[model samples]
Target chain A: MEQHLVDCDLCFDALQVLQQQQYREKYQPLSASMQQYIRNSIKQVSHAHKAERYQRQEQKKESFLIYFWVVAAIAAGAGLIYLIQQQDKFKPSVTKAMASNAEIPAQRVEAPAVQAAVVTPVRAERADTLSHRPAPPAATTTAPVAPPAATPAPATPKPVIKDSVKAKTPAAVPVNKDSAKKQAPPATKPAEVKETVKAPAPEHKDTPTVAKKTEDKPEPKPVPKEKKDDDDDKPKPKPATETAASGTDEFLYKAAMVYHQQGDLNEAISRYKHLSGSSGKYGELSRYQLAVCYRSKGQTGKARRMFKEVVRMNGSMKDKAQAALDNL
Target chain B: MLQQLSNLSDKELISRARKLKDQEAEGVLMERYSHLMVAVCLPYLNNGPATSPEEIYPALLQRLSDSLKTQTIPKANEWIHYTIRAQQARTDKNSPFFPSTESREQQQIEARIEKAATNQKEQQQLIATIERTLDKLSAEEKYLLKEFYMNNKSFAALAETKQISIEKLRQTLQQAKQKMASLLMNETYE
Candidate 1:
């Protein structure tokens, strides 16, 4: 047989085949016990793999959700900041309107003696001619009072009134009315006292409306302050999730699925690049999907490369790889 | 074992292992090569009918698991053949096979397999020197030889698994046999 195998090519090949088959026939059957052992080992290994794969998928799913929530939280924070800034902008105008209404009563309280002096008849005729000329000065003084009337805080009330009094350089007489009422028995005049107390009602009406709004939606103060401090203490996490730029492999892999689902094929292809750099089970899947995407877009070269990658990186992907290769 | 092989496309066998998770596919793989285990155990049991293959199979299966753990053999075929020869020698020493040159040859075959022949040239030289010259082929060639030899697969099934035409598969295998004959020829010359 050896000599014959050496001399003739077909006979030699047949001889090797014949001997091998004889060996197989002699001892190929497994005993029941061996079969059980094999079955047990296989089951154990498969279960382990199934468990591990499930765990990996669960972890990936959890991470994906975490990333989504982080992005949502950042957007909500930005929106809230814009709202607060908008509210702050309008705050000064409302406060200014309240301040102006408050100042009107303080001016009214000081004019009682002047009104009493004008009530006498002989003196009133002489006073009427002088008062007519003085009316322009009085009108100018009232115009100067407008800005201080609108100022909100009483602590700054004196400075604003002083500036208004200065602007009406000739309205020094009404300021004297204020000082005189401050010094003398003007508060002692019964009718004037009643008028002075009543003037504060309109001023109070303007202030309470703004005070009610402040109470309704209390500002997020202490919480934002503590959060800001904690944010400072920790390294701020890359602004939570800024739409991670193009070309980052991890981000690209993650974003590829997102963009593909969004029907942005161009962007999906762009991100699939990161996925192709490494080849494994998931990587093979990525290539197969990418090829499908490319084929749908009529890009044969890229589709071919991706499909070929699946074949070259074959293991789990062998059938898919073969199919793609056959198609190509 | 069926699930594991089912998991792998014949193409997957060509790629480098990406992750150890691919080991899941090893189940059907063991089944595919389960008969080879008998070939391994048969040579070990000369006085076989009373001891029974059932009893011998558990120890052989344990050895298979141990072999996988050691990663000493890359392809299942090489490990199967080597284990058969090795186990036969151990059994012969303890149980008394032929009480002749059979024991010596089995020991020699085991030693030849164990000898480190790193490069293809050294390995081919060793195969020539060794009386049993089947050890020199590359991992893929070894697998084809076994599928053709131990499994008794049809040419079509072999071709399908190998992802080649049956004609091509036959030609490649014929070339492998020629190389084996050539190595055996070198043995006579040396």
Candidate 2:
């Protein structure tokens, strides 16, 4: 129909003009009642539009409030996550301190000694032996003699511990021992230190609270004896050398991590190598991490070698190897 | 007729024709709408009708007036018809003029119109074409068309209410006049 009308624009325009002219001749044929009925409908439609507009405006306001609440909920969730993460970071440190404080309840003889054990490695060995003895020492003496033997690295143990303790001298040993012997229950001393650290039991009213300085200056004895025993077995080897040669990745990895945490990169790197060269899950991780340790210690050459070896070995840890190589 | 349609509401247009003798709005509405309305009607109008317009036009206009009386003319876009026989029945069934027969024929016509625009694209195109051509006017012109064709207002009354001279009102309506001309002409190109 449109195609037929396209013959000429002028012809179409003329036809339109004629149609309009014809239309004007006779347009209105409506009576009065029809006009009134239509007027009422128009009023109804106008009123409906106004009501609809108000409803839509209310919906818009409700949606805006919903949007605001959703954003607030998200912000609250994020803040909660941050708070939890911050608490997690500090939680371990606080627990460690609290653990020391709550150590004594029934007979706290074990706790001060355990705390001293952590602070002074020299006294730790003595505390361990004394903790196992039939009775607690009446005075705190000869505490240093115990740590070297218990640790098996007797010579190195004393000097390092003494250096740490020099800043805070343990009380005179015999005087401390005299107070402790009077205070401690002779029967319960053997049961005090368990293989797994015991929970501090509830306080007993019968127990004496003696604040005799327990971490005594260690007695110097037979340091040369333990070193000589290690030397006699392998004349030139140190106790660390022996442990390193054991190739137990779990133990070595742990020792390396401890050293790493203590900021001893050279020692950590050496221990990490001992573990990395062995086979295990820890061994694979240790090899990758050892390279990182070497890099941290500024031994790039050694780091590159370790990283290359890790990539050459096929395992689930290959991705880790690749990442280390990329770092190199 | 188009000017009257522009002034009158659909209800008034139908109502005015209802009381008339020969039912004049049918020819005037069709003549004014001959180009566009025939296109709308063509799909609903049967080719079989030679003398059918006699029964058909009056019946269709009367039905349209009946639909207006019942406020159903707005949906005439959906209720297009081929023969006035169904409309005659529709009018008779609810007629102040004459009682009608039950219309199976109107249902059939409605079904056929539905079938003609089966493909979604075709249906969409039909609706789109109608909307675009009708929407060529500004909001005011569209409102005027709604008043005149659908509401049945008079030109003299509209001119008086708008507080304008008839000549000024005609001039103001020229934009819509030109658009309707182009729509009738089918020349939107330039």
In order, the Cα lDDT scores of the candidates are: 0.50, 0.46
lDDT of 1 at B21: 39
lDDT of 2 by residue, B109-147 (tens): 334448756678766755565467678777878776566
Model 1 chain B: which ten-residue window has the lowest total lDDT? B94-103
TM-score for chain B of all predictions: 0.38, 0.28
Per-residue alpha-carbon lDDT of model 2 for A1-328, expressed as tens digits? 2222222222233345335544323223222223333344344434356458669989999999999999999999999999999787556434432432342231245434544554244345434344324223411233454554555655544553454334223432332233233433432333234211211110111110110111111121123223322112221122224344334344456556767788888767766654453444665677777878888888888787777766666666778778877876
Clashing pairs in 1: A100-A149, A100-A150, A314-B12, A315-B12, B1-B27, B1-B28, B2-B28, B4-B25
On TM-score, the leading prediction is 1
What's the CA RMSD for each of the models? Answer: 31.5, 21.9
Error of 1 at A285 (Å): 70
What is candidate 2's TM-score against the reference? 0.24
Q: What is the DockQ of candidate 2?
A: 0.02
lDDT of 1 by residue, A1-328 (tens): 3222222333333334335665446543443445566778667656667678779999999999999999999999999999999766545433432332342243233223333442233123323323334454653555476656545534333353444444532443343234333433332233243224323322322233333332222233223224423212111111222222112334345456656777888767755643553323445566677887797788888787767766665557768767875786
